[model samples]
Target chain A: MRVCVLNGFDSEEMTVAQERKLEQELEVLNQKGDTVDYFKLRDRKIAYCLGCWDCWLKTPGECRIKDEQEDILKSFVKTDHLVFVSNVRLGFVTATLKKTMDRLIPNFLPYIRVYQNEFHHYPRYEKTPILHTRLIVDHTVERDEIDLIEDYFKRVALNFGSDLKSFKIIDGKGEEDYEFADM
Target chain B: MLICNGSPRGEMSNSATIAKWFLKDQDKVILLMKGPKHQEYLDILAAYDHIVFIYPLYVDAMPGIVKAFFERVAIADGLMAGKKVSFIIHSGFPESVHLEVLERYHRILSKKLGFVLADTIVIPGSEGFRLMPPKQNRKKQQDVMKLMDQFRIDQPFDDHLVRRLAGKRQSNKMRNFIFSLLEKTGITNLYWNSNLKRNNAYNKRFDKPYTEL
Candidate 1:
């Protein structure tokens, strides 16, 4: 299966050891009969959703504003499974992941119905499940914060008609145990 | 009132309208948008004595710029430590169960970063109601006015009123929606209830101290 792993970790200042550990984890997932492709969102300048509702009424399956959203949407459509890995900031998902999700809303056009009182959406893919994982780098988060973030991820996955397959909380000890070759 | 408009929609936003109600008669108010700011705008935020963050909840949490603003404030740690802080969160859901998610964020900031969190007001989206227009905007304004009246600048917080208010406004619609959404989305059966239990089992695993990287 083609498994696209989008790592939102700001890799520009990553330590050598941290980089190796992330690579190892991806390798492990890859070795397990899954093809992995990753994107670092910090390198890209993505805009937030304007809530124009134009995507639903006029544009149909595309956002009105032109930016990196179109390209990311194209990539998501072609992939079988999507993985979002990021470092937790202030007990929440990184801004990069949040922005990426906001940008992807246009792809759900026609398939999703959002009213004032309720939101209804058809499954994007019948057989293909979007499996997501939020790997938090231990240093910047607290235990309660992690709990809140985990719950947020689950809620989001449910909202998107997707599944949160797993949550890997990597503290210092588990850092060395991550094997990316198996990805 | 400090209104943090994180939605890209700007003025038409349901949350912004609510914030406006609270700003009545106030000589100074800080309206911070995500991408639009001149040096003067930044200076205004720096001059605030108390902050009231009003924003739409995205993905069960505060918007990115809301978090980013705290990071950019540089003095957030010092300013928030003993200062009055509150939230007016607007969401599309009928109930505001997701407000807990925001409270969780505040808890982290208060406990770890030394910010003092005051009362939080949550206004559920007005979508399916029969008689009312979207009252979130109006309600938010009234709510902030009420909060200001209830607030005592020099006194310690009275937990009784806060708890009573939070309890009275609690809606089961949000809880039901979260569960229903999970099942409707096909992710409900992916993991067993046991897995859910295990995920929340804090003490079963090793008791190693959590280290911040």
Candidate 2:
């Protein structure tokens, strides 16, 4: 299975111990033989979606802005499963991740379609991947915050026509507590 | 009242039109357009009795700029305890349920920030206003005035008005059938087709630029 991980937390903010745990999680995925790709948002330059609708009516399926996100978007769309790893800062995903979500407008056509009793922009591509949200939690996070993030992703799942597989919180603890579920 | 325009388009947004009409006297309302600058907003957040947020929904969530503002609020730089915060969220899709989750989230945030949630007004099919003429906005303007009259007295919007503004969530079977006929006639997509043709992108309207490498 193809897996893509989007890391929204700044690298400078992560401690070495947390980094080791993240590496262990990746090693587990690697040992399972799943094709894995990790995208650290800090390394790339991403622009906000201007809502121009050019990708819709003009250059269909492609954003006009020149940025590193073009390739990242490709991997995000083609993967079999998608993972969002972000430390809870303001009770949800970081602004970096939110900007990437805004830039994902190209994934859908401007044309509207009715699905599940609601109107949604039709997909530009045919396939939909499974979504997994792994939040890096801090002491500030409450049960309601976690549930709200999960609920938000369920909305994301519905929009992308993807199945919401799971939502988990990963603390600074060692990777021994983490296990790669069989895909 | 402070009116914060959270649309990515900033000033030239459909939400701006809604905001303009929603006000009884434009002078008393302060319009703050969301920009890259965040620190400027922090000082002004506490001074107002009421703050109105007008934004377009992106991917079933707040736009990145507005989300950043929410993050600022979450950080607790100011006291939001006594202020009344209201939202006027509009979306491209014609579904009230699509914005329902965010409304709940807003309610949660309201509680967390200790602000009074005035009302969460979700306007589905808001994008349609762009395609129509200026004359069509009069009714919405009047509706906005009536809402303000109620808000001035510290009252919430009537349920019937909210239902009316939200429009139909799902197109009924009969309407869907009629729309199919309209689609065949090219009337349903006339707005999009005309805009595409105006920009000389009509031929490439369905072009898929991204291919699997």
Candidate 3:
């Protein structure tokens, strides 16, 4: 399976030990025969979505902003499994990941559809990747905050015409307990 | 009082309309969140005892720019603590169910950041609110004005009024069927279709660019 890990970790907050553990986890996935592709979002130049309807109206499934996000958008639709890796901030994923998510409008059309008695956009592609979130949280985070994050991701998956296959919250210790094989 | 406009479109956004209408007389300065003035805005926000954050929902959550502002707030650490915060979240969809989880998140976020939760106002059918004719949106605007008039800076929204403003959580089967019929007749997508036609991309509306990959 092809897995795309979009890491949105803050460089200042990521500890050396946590960085090593992340590498070790990816290595384990590699040994397990999963084609792992990782993108560190902080290193790339991605602009915020201008809320311009150009992607939907003018360009048609293409964002007008000329930036590094085009490759990420292509990979997102082509991958078998897309993993969102980010450290929790303000009870949700980092803004880096959120900005990337906003730019993904090109994956869907400008039209609307009725699904399960609710309004949603139509998918532009024939298939979409299964979604997953691997969030790192501090001990101060509460159970409700975790639940809220899970619930929000579930809604995102549903809207994207996929299911949230897995959601893993990794603390500093016992990182080995959660494996990529589970995904 | 501090009012933050979290829409990427900045002042021209529909979220800005709500902010302007809500505080018509008092301070009318709406802080745009999509700019490079994060630290300056944070400094201004720290002095206010009450804050009103208005943003259009993007992908069923706060806009990325709004989340970016929250990240800065998280870093500030206690700068917003105990400040009464009210959120006005609007979305394009007519149903309020899509925004319920985000509203719940705001409730928990107040606790997490040590801010006092004033209220969360969810406005649906907000896609083209600013572009629509005033006569057509008069009733909806009146409803919001009534709600805002009753709003107390230090307290949560009135439960009865909040429920009324949210309209329906989800459409019933008959309503969905009617909407589907409208969609088939192409009345529901007039806004999108017109924009597509103007851009000359209406012929390629359903074009799938990434299918080959």
Candidate 4:
């Protein structure tokens, strides 16, 4: 399966240890023979989506603003599974990850078609196996907090018509205990 | 002003405890609990002059509700143009590493709406403030009040000072050891910790307390 991991951690000056741990996790996933593609949201300049409905009304399958987000969304369409890793901020996903999810709205837009007697708009993904992982640093969150966030993730996965295979809460205590290491 | 109480516990939140003091005597104070009414609150935010966001840090970042609120507002840019923005972020974690997350959102809001970003006031969570009684929380509350006075005086927020105070000194080996212990225990319930225990134990409502500027 082709797996794409979109990381929303800001990496401007990540410590050497942090970088290596992330790379090692990705390497392990890649070695599993799953063609894993990684995209860092912090590396790109992604603007918030303007609720102009332009993507739906005027431009088909495209956001109004011309940016790197469009290409990233397109890539998600081609991938078999998508893994979104975000450092939990406050008590939820980071703004970068949230913006990325907001920009992906175009991908799920219904393409109108005549099914039987009346014209019906069918969503792009009738059923797709999409595995999502939310790796929050252990030091940053307590165990009770994970349940609430996992519930939100489940809802998000359901909204996208994908099966949420697992929710991995990684306590960034060390490389050894990293959830991705076990994977 | 739009004041977002970003604690999951709603009214019984430490951030709200501090915010009430800062906003007392003000005519307009909109309290937004992190849930369904958020969109309704955003619509109302357009009419406000100053936007004060009071949130607790979750995983070194703003809570999901805050992010969702921003997404909703950012989509409709100019909803808060020419408005002053300030923040009172509370976090159990020591370092202000989480402040960068707020800074990023501030930049996004500033770029989109052309608003004046006011100084942000961040309070470190007390050792047991979340679970401590108001009387017990007096010292931390006083500290927050002092910060508010400085905020009203237009004192520039010194990021360097904040960073120095909140810097993490743990070695990678220590981090690794902790991670290994959690993994070995097969404890998927890693989110449950001493912080929550404290937060649940002492979270309460009290009269707003602030220093007059």
Q: Which candidate ranks first by DockQ, i.e. highest?
A: 3
Give the per-prediction TM-score of chain B.
Answer: 0.61, 0.88, 0.91, 0.64
What residue runs in model 2 are displaced by over 4 Å at the alpha carbon? Answer: A10-20, A171-181, B24-34, B173-186
| Highest lDDT scorer | 3
State, as a TM-score between 0 and 1, how close model 1 is to the true structure.
Answer: 0.74
Model 3, B15-50: lDDT tens digits are 877765666655535556546888888788887777
Rank candidates, DockQ, best first. 3, 2, 1, 4
lDDT of 3 by residue, A1-183 (tens): 888888888665554455567778788989988888888888889998889979899989888998999888888777898888777777887889888989999999877888867888888888788998887877877788889889988989978888899998888563544467777
Q: Candidate 4 DockQ category?
A: incorrect
Name the top TM-score candidate. 3
Mind giving the per-residue lDDT tens digits that candidate 1 earns over A47-161? 7666665554454455778886666666666667677777766556666777777666555522333332335444333333465665656665567877777777776666666
Locate the minimum summed-lDDT window of 10 residues in model 1 chain B.
Answer: B204-213
Better of 2 and 4 by lDDT: 2
lDDT of 3: 0.81
Reference-based lDDT, residue A160, model 2: 86
Estimate candidate 1's alpha-carbon lDDT, on a 0 to 1 scale: 0.57
Q: Please compute DockQ, using alpha carbons, for every candidate against the native two-chain complex.
A: 0.13, 0.56, 0.78, 0.04
Query: Candidate order by TM-score, highest to lowest?
Result: 3, 2, 1, 4
CA lDDT of each candidate? 0.57, 0.74, 0.81, 0.57
